[model samples]
Structures are given as C-alpha cells and as structure tokens.
Target: MSLPTWELIRAAGLTSYFLLFVSVSSGLLFSIKAAKPKTNQLLQVAHQSAGWFSLLFGLFHGLLLYIDTYKPYSLVEIFIPFTTKDEPLLNGLGTISLFIMVLLFISGDLMKKVGAKVWKKIHRLALPMVILISTHGIMLGTDSSNGWAIVLYASSLAIILSLLIVKLLLIKAKTKKVISA
Candidate 1:
C-alpha cells in the first residue's frame, strides 16, 4: 500500500507533534519525581530522548513540505516565524513552537550557566509552545476536520492545561503562606 507524498507529510508532522507531547510529559514526570526520590534516572533521559525525536521528526516533516511540488516552502518560510507566504498565521505558529523547543533543548546546559531560576523561567515557554503547535496542526493540517485529530488536540490540551493549573495553584498557595508567615 503506497501512500502519497502529502499523506507522508501529514503523518510526519502529526507523529513529530506527538513526540513533542511525550517529551513534555516526560519532563513533568521527572519534575514530580521529587515526591518519589526512588524514581529512575531513565525518566530524565527519556525526556531528553523524546525531545530529540520530536526535533528529528519535525525536521522530517519540514523537509517533506519543502520538497513538495504542489506548494514548496522556502528555507526562510521553514525556519522564520510568520514568514511563510502560504498559511502565514497557521504555519507561523509551528515556527514559533519550533523556536521554543530549541530553547528548551539548550535549557539544561543553561541551567548551570544561568541560575536555576532563570533557566526554569525560560523553560516555562514549553506550555505556550504546546498550545501553539496544537493550534498550528488543527488550523493548517489536512486532518483538521477529522474527529480523531480534534479529539487528540482536545485531550492533549486538557492534560497540559490541567498540569499547568495545578502548578499555578500550588505556587499561589506557597506565596500566600510565605506572606502570612
């Protein structure tokens, strides 16, 4: 069963985005491991690996689009945010998300060079990157009208939003406790 080039592009992009989600999930798992100090070092490694996979698959997706005869993407369109002639806003989100992911990639090394607080502050961009990519896929993807794609987007959003909300609440509570004491 041979698939068309367009289909391959969709598959590559969707799979890459999924890896990005997995990377984010693994990062959360690593963070929560503080509650269970016995957690394996593998968790952190998995997070790093997933990020690498996401980058690889994302490059694959971009390359496929660049080579597509139907509507070829220039290198600038591929790398620069909001520079694409086609689907400027939609594809722009993907570019912005890519920038964020790259920042996250180097954040571990930066954690030592910069203080942990600064590094962590930069890392928080992951949340916005997730939302941006999901928006990009939904708005620009061929599967935008597909029920499964919508569900995937919704479910991913729910998980990430919930986690962010919980973290925000915990931070607020901690701040309040400190102020009162």
Candidate 2:
C-alpha cells in the first residue's frame, strides 16, 4: 500500500531535521577541536554531505505540502513567510528558517571564495537557524507530541546547546590567552 501524502510530508520533515542536526554537530566538533585530524577530515565530509541532504529534504518537505489533499499549500504559501491563513506565524517561522538554511549552505560551499573572515560571520547564523528551525518543528509539527519525536527534539536541543556552550568557553579562553601573551 502506498503511504499517504501527509505521512510522506512528515517523514521528509523529520528526516531533514535529523540531517540538519548531524551537520551542525559535525561543524561544532570542528570548531571545538573535539576531533583528531583524521577524524575531523571524515567529519568535514559528513558535514558537507549532511548539509546538502538537509536542504534537499527540507525543500522536499515543503513541496510535499503542495500535494497534500487536506489543506494544501500554494507555492507562495510554501516559500513566502506569513502568506498563509492557517498558522501563519508558525509556518512563517519555518519558511524564514528554511531560507536561512539555504543561505548558510550556499555560503558554506563558497567559504574559500568568500574568505574565512566573511564566511565565519555567515556561519554564525547557524545558531539562530537551529533555534528557529527547532521552534518551528516543535510548535507546528503533527508528530511532535509522539514520544520518539519528543525525545528527538529534546535530545537534539540538549546536545546542540551543550556544544555551543563549550565552543563559547573555548573561544573566551583563547581570547584571554592571546591578551595575556
């Protein structure tokens, strides 16, 4: 039996979210010097691949909404923020987050051409992107109430936040050391 469109949409969304979590985690590991050189190389590959997959799945999730029989979304509603009558605010958050993710992905690929300084500035947006994406999913996702979904969201948040804290502390320590030197 064929899976329903709504189920497909939900699956795509969840898969995209998980891929995004992987990409961010890999990036954080590199930033915090948590991996050995050889392992870091593998992480770099995973980070880039996961990022592309996340964007593709995210786009697919949005597109699937168009094909949904119940409360179908228009192209405008899918791409444009706050254009829909139903749950405009929550959906708009998702649309905005997705756009930010796209920007991050494109800029990441062009990091060398853009220069490390500029690329790092753009990369900082990842934190806010994660926040917005998580909020959008937890607030709007149909499966969010399920036990597995709840665990996924909670654990993802906890791990990401913990890594971010470590990154910040390491940066502060380095800055202090440079000043003392």
Instruction: Return the lDDT, model 1, position 59.
Output: 77
Clash number for each model: 0, 0
CA lDDT, candidate 1, residue 29: 62
Provide the global lDDT of candidate 1 against the true structure.
0.81
Listing every candidate in turn, what is its Cα RMSD in Å to the true structure after a full C-alpha superposition? Answer: 2.5, 1.4
Candidate 2 C-alpha lDDT tens digits along 48-127: 89988998999999998998977789999999999988999889988887898888877877988998898888888888
Question: Over 4 Å off in model 1, which ranges?
Answer: 1-3, 33-35, 40-42, 179-181
Candidate 2 TM-score to native: 0.95
Model 2 misplaced stretches (Cα beyond 4 Å): 1-3
